[model samples]
Target: MTAIYRSAAGAAAVRDRYDTLLDRWPVPSGRRTVRTRLGATFAVVSGPVDAPPVVALQGSGGTAAHWLPDIATLAGRLRVYAVDAPGEPGRTAEARPPLTSPAYAEWLDDVLDALELPRAAFLGTSLGGWWALDHALRRPARVTALALVNPAGIGRRRIAPLLKFAGYRLFGAWGRRRSLAMVAKGSPADPGRRAVGEFTFATFEHFKPRLEAIPVVPVERLRTLAMPTQAHFGAHDVLLDQRDAAAKLREAVPHADVRLAEDAGHFLPGWAGSVVTFLEGERS
Candidate 1:
């Protein structure tokens, strides 16, 4: 059995917690299990049946449940598919594909194929942003639009945040919470956000995360994305060089809409409205 948790019990605990959050999903939603070459992928589907489709990807070590706060607003306009990527702490396969290859884009191709979507927009955060960007670069024809939040693979990687996180780990649970709070700045103070935060803490308590270097998307390739693209960066983010990332993206794709939030960090909360507006505009 493929698992990202330290033990089977840990996996069950995470799943149970995730399920509980889904039970409180502010809007009507359903689960989707799509077969792909990488493995069986899972997505929490929301929105109207006839609405424009958008596939959402979460950050590393996160699941679809993390998107609960945004679903109600997002599903109000377009069809939303919050996908749990392979190798992450979700129901997806535990196949850790190499970051340097085209495997991820191909896996996404299979997902789109199974979903029967000829074209769709994409919403991704951090590692998920990198995956969506990779797919857009590899298959520009299929992506209608792009929405990235504190995405990786744009600027040079820094070691300070990783080292700081390591130091926090030495102090045990208290330190871990500090690490999460420090890294995930600007999380909204809402009930759904709180539930997600609790679930995140529980997940990291027993889950093992990927340690490989996140691959950077070459700046030149950014020009190939003819589709509408909007990227949001948090100025306080410690995990990535958000300023440099935003600069490079603006330089490469001059037409791209990029925003840098001075008060936000890597985890952007309370910004779902802007994302929904962007995606909804694309449909018209």
Candidate 2:
């Protein structure tokens, strides 16, 4: 299969930066490598052995380490497994599955089977949220619960202004930063803000994400998620309207809990505790 990266050198450079940030991971962690039809999948596990498994997915151009705050927060409470999504800028396979089919769900099933976990909770951000919802709809029995942060796929994808593909491909770093500036809107005092900026910029500059437009799943399809589900969105999200996404989700899944974070943008203010509490309700 053809690698998704724009260039081998770019991929290697991004990986070097990814490894550098990962080396600074504050928590104790273990790495797991699983083989699936999609390709080799990688997940970073943290937290206690006795706790229930909670698989997490990050957004576009994001790696498992991007969920560092969530992993740290859920350390002792739940065993967190952050999957480095295949086809993205991570340690996972460069082969991207078609977004139009059940390929993602099947790939996830393979990962879970390889890990010997039958049913575990799920938490996803942006594109990850879309994948989580996809899995829940396709393999409902495998997902114990669902949580999303500024997730896409629930509504029509909004067009991003001033962030053109040509710009990213031609100008590189500057264009990536221009795009990142729209979402890396954390509090200025955030000590990790600089690192996040640097990482995202590098990801955009190096990783070649699938250009396929992620289609909106049918409402009837979304209605099949029977597990406890919560979806969170940033009020000021530049990509999608949180209120619109919330209304659509509530209409599709009447029992789903939806929230709009007042201070959050697309990147979101970390709400790991809120997600953990919701998942715990399903367990306890």
Candidate 3:
């Protein structure tokens, strides 16, 4: 089959950068490859063998390296399995499946089964969050707890100014960096984050990532998710109306714990600690 990357050289460069990122990880980890019918999924596993498991899903155009900050904290007390979401700009197979189907749920289940884990807490950000919810709605028995960080599809996603995206496509890295800065939380002063951002921009220049309009689950469906669930939103995420998302989640899923981080953006605040608390503690 033809490759999804714009060019083999571009894919090689991204992987080389990703290799360097693996060296700077906060904790020790091992890479595991899980083969599925759709594709071969890749994951970086860390932490204690006997600890409760937490499956992490990366945002769009994101790789496992993006979770470096969270891994140190979450892995201290729990096993962290960060997957390279297939079809995104990662090492996973470049097989893009329709988002509006049960494929993601099935794929996620396959991942869990491959890991020999029947149930585990889930942590997802942006597009990853949507996948977690999608799987929970389809197979609630597999997800022990859920955390959505600045997720999409909860409310109507706000479209960024077309001109902003246009500029990135037109002017290359400079414009791409500008667009990323608009929603990113902190400056890329950290070498790890800087490297990740570079790959994200290079992805934009090469591959055309599949864009899907994540549909909001019906309020009835939202209420049916009986597992312990929480959602974190950025107070000022330009990518979505977080205020609206918080309000709707409160109304539809009264049992949910929803929090808005002040002055935060779509990149999300360093709230891995909060997610750990939610997963480890009983829901009120």
Top-lDDT structure, candidate number: 1
Pick out the ten consecutive residues of candidate 1 with the lowest summed lDDT.
Answer: 193-202
Q: Give one digit per residue, the lDDT tens place, for model 3 in 190-227.
A: 66556666667666666656666677777787878888
TM-score of each candidate structure, all chains considered together: 0.95, 0.93, 0.93
lDDT of 1: 0.86
Q: Please give the distance, in angstroms, between residue 12's alpha carbon in candidate 3 and its true position after superposition.
A: 1.7
lDDT of 2 by residue, 253-280 (tens): 9999888777777778767788877876
CA deviation > 4 Å runs, candidate 1: 1-3
Is candidate 1 or 2 superior in TM-score? 1
> Distance from true position, residue 19, model 3, in Å?
1.9
Q: Per-residue CA lDDT of candidate 1, range 1-284, in tens?
A: 34567988988888887888778888888899999999999998999988889999998888998788778888998899999999988788888878998899999999999999888999998899999999999998889999999998997777887788777777887887787788768866677776676677668777888888998878888878888999999988888889999999999999999999998988787667888888888872
Error of 2 at 25 (Å): 1.7
